[model samples]
Target: MKILDKYILKTFVITFTSVFVILFFIFILQTVWLFISELAGKDLDFILVIKFLMFAMPRIIPLVLPLSVLLASIMSFGDFAENYEFAAMKSAGISLQRTMKFLTFFILILSLGAFIFANNVIPYAEFKFINFRKDIAQMKPAMAIAEGQFSDVGSYNIKVDKKSGENGNFLTGITIHKKSNNFDGSKNVIKAKNGELISNEKSNILKLVLNDGYYYEDIIPKKYEERNKIPFAKSSFKKYIIYIDLSKLNNTNNEDYTISNTNSMLNISELKYTIDSLENNRKKDIISFVDNSYQRTVTQGSLSSNKALNDSIITTKIKNPDLLSNFIPKEQSEILQIANNSIINTNYTIDSTEQELESKTKVINSHWIALYDKFVIAFACILMFFIGAPLGAIIRKGGLGLPIVFAVLIFIIYHFVNTFGKKIAQEDGLTPFLGCWMATFILTPIACLLTYRATNDIGFINMDVVLLPFQKLFKKIFPSQNQ
Candidate 1:
């Protein structure tokens, strides 16, 4: 029995390792295709491209590991089934469930290791991947002006509506935004009908010549000038020259990347902390908004000749257009003044609500999704192992041919369901727990069904059972006519 267990384990281990390498390389090709445009023709260093791929590799592991387990298990067990190895084992008094014990233990360990990698390695890789992508985008400042997309270049962000000329240099309908300084928080915008970029790599400067453009720069208001509108200067230039410094573009040589507390960059524990903080702050904002709205609508009563007052009355109640019949001339002016203030306050409330809701979704739901996602993929590894092993026995078709087809089909379904759940979760349509685990709930039952069928040695569909009743009904309906 010990010798047999070792023999079974040897094939499983070898198949698993080979499948992992094949699947990892296959998924890397997908990553390359996705960002090929970002890397191609940008004159980037080979080392930068390699670093980008290296950082991106970890993100794909979580996606591939489960699929590899499925494929390898299916292929290995399919071979065992085809060779009637299970029959020989059963003849020797070994049950199918007993045969799975060692493999099951191995799979559990792999699942835990996957969890560790997801928690520790992926977060670091994701952070580096994002920053490396940014650095690559900066390699050619001109290419950064991608049509219909905002591209950040140094301290300025540029977008061009139409791009023409060789290497996409000539631009039309251009908008440029310089980063706002922290001190005053004013925006500087440049809108141009067209522009052309000329790079001076030797001096680390980019010259953008704009034709028929207007420059708009916001002037920060003094503390006392808060009530006044923020003053801005706008002027038109037939031809303007804007100098952009590129000295800081990838200046670190890919060393020190600033790790943001953004959802994608943070691990599970960091994610939980950020989620709690955002929820607490969001609650405070809701309370503050409600208080401000109440203060605006209800105020202390002032003595009136035609007293129709409570300690506090909503401004709307007193001066509502529908309540014109109750109007008193002396209170009319005051009511009108209060009515205008109430209108402004209502709009303010609406804007505040929208802004806070967006912030909460961005800061809270995103982190929650990331947190749940870590566990989902880790658990999927174990789940896929069960699914694949049994499916292999039932199919009884070994080698890459049939196993590849089944593995890819199942993975596509899994990946699609997982992506759908995450999308709805991000939209707040479902709770984080439900949305993140949605696929697991749906797939677990299928896995169980397959396992039961394989253990009982039932055929994939039990076609004869399904067709017998239909055949009998057909015979009854037509009586076969002795044909």
Candidate 2:
């Protein structure tokens, strides 16, 4: 590298590294705050928390890199201008473009790094981080137990009174209450006097080894005449095994598997997959609705026939009261009334199913649209840079204060426009891709204009007129703005 090229490259690297480190710290702090909030009552080790953050860094780096590049380039170039380094180079016959050559190469290298991180590392990290969080949440009971507080591990609620012996590995005086309410209005509560949690690593089952406990069931009799309490007392066995449902923990594996199943981390491809899946689901739902509607039509027709039959029977009985008493018993009439009520209930159920299916279809469609929007937002980062860099040069104030303010204002405007477009797209049937890129498209021309004006020294907006009111008045009176 030439001496000047090396000098410029060093400045670029230093500035970019500083910005990246600052932004990475900021990302870490925000992530930690969110994680702390989420894991507030749960028990997680400090090492695991640190690991989670470390895994998250790769994902955050790609997002921070591009912005860091922009900031670094602008700062380095502005410093060169401020220090009269550019004038020195110009005097030596080096053009402005020549001065920027090294910086551009640096940017290209940074861009390539960002592409690798985004495509390869970030996706894997995201998948791992998510799974780690889920595992931590699932194993919270083992990690977050207090001496005298009730802790929920999966479906079972356990309380431990004392912890001692060998680094608190053994939990003494443990009480567990297992409640299952799956059946219609039936509850089973198992109370264990002394239980130790044993996790089988191979099978992933958390076994509650109960020393002495009783199972109590309050059964409502089928006759409806009496309620009975059935109790089973522990006698022979020292330990009773209550298996924790490992299926709940295994459910997250599907999401992990799905993430790992795909090789490419392209946002557009993911969006397309989501759209296709949603469309297929929608089609299935439509078919289900049609089948349900057909069934409901048949049921309604049957119910109408039943109603007519009952009406006919009542009319005939009313005409002959003596026959009603003799031919139809009082119990038979009551049974008929109950049967009619059941038919009415069946009609209500069909109506409810239809409504639920309609609601689900709408939700699925909304999800598909949302995925499409996210795909567009991912690409907008590249578009935003084209606008941000040129605007920075035109503004020409490279201190922390003005650059930050400018970046924030520009970002806010972009975010607001993008959000507005999404809302319109959702409500009306506006194009999803267009809605997402609207802000980028609108600002791109502005960026180009700023770049042209800065390069050519067109002075599109005179700063002196805005800063000094007298200059504006003088220009208006004299009719020669430049003079």
For all predicted structures, in order, the TM-scores are 0.74, 0.66
Candidate 1 Cα errors over 4 Å, as ranges: 137-248, 254-256, 300-324, 329-344, 474-483
CA shift at 351, candidate 1, in angstroms?
A: 4.8
Please estimate how well model 2 matches the true structure, expressed as its whole-model Cα lDDT: 0.61
Candidate 2 residues 1-483, lDDT tens each?
799889878876787788779988997888888777445644556776777787778766644654565565556666666577766887898865676677666555555556545655665676777666656655533553456777666676767777544334356676656656566455545555565656654565666576766665556566654544532334344567777765455444454343343222334456467667766876787788678767865654334344645554545544555543533565456545655776786678668877866665555445444445444434444454445445555555565666676666666676688778766654544565566567767877876776676556454497776778986677788886565
Error of 2 at 480 (Å): 20
Residue 64 in model 2: lDDT = 61
Candidate 2 residue runs with Cα over 4 Å from true position: 1-6, 37-47, 61-63, 87-116, 137-141, 144-150, 159-162, 167-169, 172-179, 182-195, 210-241, 247-274, 287-384, 415-430, 458-460, 463-483
lDDT of each: 0.81, 0.61
Error of 2 at 212 (Å): 7.4
Supply candidate 1's per-residue lDDT for 344: 80
